[model samples]
Target: MVSKSRSEWSTILSHLVLAAVSLHAAVTSAQSSRGAAAGFLLQTFAAITMLVPGLNTHEDCLAGAWVATVIGLPLLAFDFHWVNGDRSSANLLLGGGMVLAVAGDHLGPEGCSVAGQAVLLVVSVTILIVAVFTANTYGIWGGAMLGVAGLLSRLEEDRLLLLPKEDVCRWALTAGSWAYCRALHTQRLQWE
Candidate 1:
């Protein structure tokens, strides 16, 4: 078994922190300029974390993608005010993502391949895009959290070992997306 070194762990920790801060800032903000600036900062860090050496692999990308999707759900809820309205769709997406993640974790090992993973990745991206368009703020975050979680489950099931690299990348991507969305929303508010 290969043991990760200190630097690797540090890199992962940084990524995780930035990711959390990205979402936290967005969720807590009252859609002010400060929140927008913080969101941009968070996205920038997220991109930087993804480019870290020895961390760019298919699995890492998938894991990163999953983290972004799963964690973004709540961010969306706050943005769209889903709690006040019928939140059945949001709830359904949340449940579906969880179910897929678990199912992927267990059933993924049965038949896994690089090509299959790639296809899944594409699907995840598509969902993210659709969420951005259809649901707006709510869709983007919710879709991200759900998509990433499901993808992570499948990757975990298939891989011989799970490393922090994938997770770091996932969180980074997720945070970056949140930042981007938050920034866009803030800019739009300024115009209104």
Candidate 2:
């Protein structure tokens, strides 16, 4: 087995922290903006995070990243509408962005194998269906992403290994999504 060097692990972890910190700051900055635009900004950030780098790969990492955006982006939009002034239409924009973002991720993995692509397709469609029927998109997305991540980590079942690079990248996206969602939730508490 080819083992990962220590430097590679360090580099991966650093990127992970960078992803979390950068997005967390964006969320904090959005707090001051206090409007539907803030949600859109976060949605934009989510697009960059997954489709760009940090979690740049063609497997569960990409799947989980899309799942996170699908879940968190909508929450950010809803909070914008219900608390940050009266922009109900922004919620729809957010919902649309969430689905579009996930679809983008599913479609863009240039290196994923047929089997890997199959996994992502199955997972994304399941989450999309649930999101359509359920009110808690966040819960559904998060759970689905976590489930796919776990499947990626498993020893068998025709899967990819969670290499150190992939590990940090995946967790970083997940952590960033959580941080932003938490910030929006905190804002909700203040309004309440």
Among these predictions, the greatest TM-score belongs to: 1
Position 102, candidate 2: lDDT: 48
| Regions more than 4 Å wrong, model 2 | 1-3, 11-57, 101-107, 110-186
Candidate 1 colliding pairs, count: 14
User: For model 2, where is the 10-residue window of minimal lDDT?
Assistant: 111-120
- How do the residues 1-192 of candidate 2 rate in per-residue lDDT, one tens digit apiece? 878787566555654554555456455646453542353354345445544555556554556445434444444445434454545544564556555654664554542233333433343344334333444455345435534543454334331333453554355335534544544454555555
Residue pairs in steric clash, candidate 2?
Answer: none
Q: After superposition, how far is residue 179 of candidate 2 from its true place, in Å?
A: 6.7
lDDT for each candidate structure: 0.46, 0.46
Task: Estimate, for each residue in 2-87, the C-alpha lDDT of model 1 and write its tens digit.
Answer: 89786667656656665566656555554443433443344434444476677756566555544333333323332232332435
Model 1: which ten-residue window has the lowest total lDDT? 74-83
Looking at candidate 2, what is the lDDT of residue 142?
A: 42
